[model samples]
Target: MTFSWRRRRSGRGGDGKSEVFKGINQDMELTIPTHFRCPISLDLMKDPVTLSTGITYDRESIEKWIDAGNITCPVTNQVLRNFDQIPNHSIRKMIQDWCVENKSCGVERIPTPRIPITPYEVTDIRSRIVAAARVGDARKCQELVGKIKDLAKESERNRRCIVGNGIGSALADSFESFARFSVDAHVNLLKEILAAFTWTFPLDEEGISKLKSAVSLRCMVWFLKSENDLSSRQNAICVLKELISADQACVDGLMGIQDIEETLFHTVKVPICPKATKASLVIIYNMIKSSKEKSGEIALKFIRMGLIHLILEILVDGDKSVCEKALGVMDSICSLEEGRENAYENALTVPLLVKKILRVSDTATEFSISSLCKLCLGENESALVEAMQLGAFQKLLVVLQIGSGERTKEKVTELLKLMNLCRDKVDCVDASMGFKYIKRSN
Candidate 1:
């Protein structure tokens, strides 16, 4: 295959420090080579990695070489980075040999090395940024910050090089490396970095602890206090979730803040991606559930601050997974009898619980319907009667008949039994109608 080259030169001095290089324009036409094709694959070099013997190159090795900036095949000394950049003589011979060796094989071209920056360089810069961040040296920190930002912008400009790059991982690693300095750095600068690459926090076990220790809750709360944009605030919540999971100390710190109730409510109310919302909910639920002191107070605060309504909204509108999670939260809140009774006395819990059940139409999943039924039954007998009066029995029966899955039918039967036990309190006609619907469906 043919290959081409473009050189980018940084306007800076010849210190090999030029940030720019002029390379081959991607639009230029080029001639193909023939003799350099692979014997087994009969294709141009792809992801060519140099073998341990230093003579043969394979696809995986080629990829590492490309990622590591060794673009030329050592044995052939052929430029393998771009198909069009290959010498025409080599291409012609490779094609002729391929045709002679395999009459049915079509010419396969290798992928071009699109990214200009090497992974090593990215790693180097990331290390320097972390080192600078460590000493709390303002000037070095600012310099590294500028470099990281420029690299990000450069990556954006070079689509070929930036695609599938490990930029996010590098950024998160750098942030964690600077954990010791996080408390000392300028909060505004930290906020800027947090805002710029908010989505880099990894959810896996390896990254969870590093993220928590590196970023303080104070810094996160600070950013949330200063920033009004929902997107940035959402990122803050994401980073916080990582920390909340890894460090109970961080969770306690967050809980001890002067106006944490407001902060928690604000975070729950913010419109965010579903994954982020789920993470936040898990973190909060775990924190509240595990706490020994004032746990009920925190639960009450969530309800008082209108977060319960938001949770219900998600339950009603979100997909099955989210609905299941919402149920878990409701279950947790109601597990504390005092909190559940208080919520009932305030007249907030029953209406929302009833709404969820009433919304369970024929389309509702059995798990969601069952969850709602379970919550209702856990409440006082008065609450169950009120829910039946709101036409929940009719909806439950519809779900039983038209719901798609086995779980749905199973829950439907369970709900029917529960409603029958409360038959004396429910409108007898509604109960009878439900019983007839069940009998007819069976």
Candidate 2:
């Protein structure tokens, strides 16, 4: 009997039943086993291609599945392709079954797993995110959130890997995708990625150096831009705080931006909310604190730009917390040689600071007074004498006497001593204010 297996036709036989046949016309025809049929092609598989599209069987057909991970066959609706390129022994078995069942000319089909999408895939995500954002599809926009999270986790792992390998430069290229996507997306994920990058600090000299470069670039963009959503702003500020430690270059890079100074002054004066005002003040304080040691040049630049007067304005407006922070910043600025030189050149910062102290109500006078005395007595004997002449002595003594804290009293006494040292320049009325208070108490 000839086992014809080349062509089959659907028909009803004489028995009145439907018939199925593999082939009908030729002798010695090879019948392809069910397993030999490509799950996707449902034919003898040829030129099998493993593509990243979640399709693994035909090079031509699977190319479309490359990015589509684990796609079902369009014809058979079977899970015919694995796009991730992750190795699975079970998938090997499926390919093996096809090889065993086919009985034509011997053809070896090697399954070449697809190459993974490079980290550059983040750009694709960024484009999609922008499109989703444009259409106001919060759901689609939110979907990118998961991808961003995955990217972030992948970036962190890569960073640790690079650090462990002592290939810090590797991390720089690794995170380029995350950084590029972050800026393109212009969302909170940028912050998350930045935070992850920063978490790898002190990894190695090279890694730390690369981190500084990355942070400087990111912060420069954030600080220089005038337009960003509140969440973006918050994220940028949070990252700034993280990268602030022991990175003078990064701190100066942030401070060197004109927009940061403008944003700060504008926001403090015309805040969108009290919370925003407070947050901005806190960021400023943190920036100052970060640059406290190596900030002399930048501090002087800001002073020359009249930042002191702006801060003084905030203090005089009764923003007690903000005022206190501004005062602390002033103390930091004046303590530095460059800052003092700038203050002397402007010839306004000391007087403004002293005036702020004198104007502060008695209830909140202690911190302001201490901050002023620290700024004035340190370098400007002349400014301290001017402060005493402005009735600052009376304010300081009153704070010393009635203030609940011993530190306040000690700070007041120290200011009096500094003032006494400059008694020749101080007016007698102002000079005697402290003694008169002391006599009354006696």
For lDDT, the strongest prediction is: 1
Q: How many residue pairs clash in each candidate?
A: 41, 8
Scored by lDDT, model 1 comes in at: 0.54
Give RMSD (Å) of candidate 2 vs. truth: 21.7
Name the TM-score of candidate 2.
0.44
Q: Write the per-residue lDDT of candidate 1 for residues 1-442, one digit (tens) a residue.
A: 4444232333334564321122324344323343354433434443333334343343433444556777565567666645222223334444445434432232233334333455567667656665665665546655665665655565343323322344444444445544335534555556555654543433344344444552445556656555455555676777677666555666766776667667756666774577667767766676567552554677667766666567766765776556656656665665565545544564545555556553544333443454455555554677667657776677666665555577667656766777788887866435444455444335
Cand. 1 TM to true fold: 0.56
Clashes of 2: 8
The deviation in Å at residue 166 for candidate 1 is 8.0
For candidate 2, the lDDT comes to 0.52
lDDT of 2 at 23: 24
Error of 1 at 140 (Å): 4.0
Model 2 stretches with alpha carbons more than 4 Å out: 1-141, 144-177, 180-182, 185-224, 228-231, 238-274, 289-292, 341-367, 403-411, 421-442
TM-score of each: 0.56, 0.44
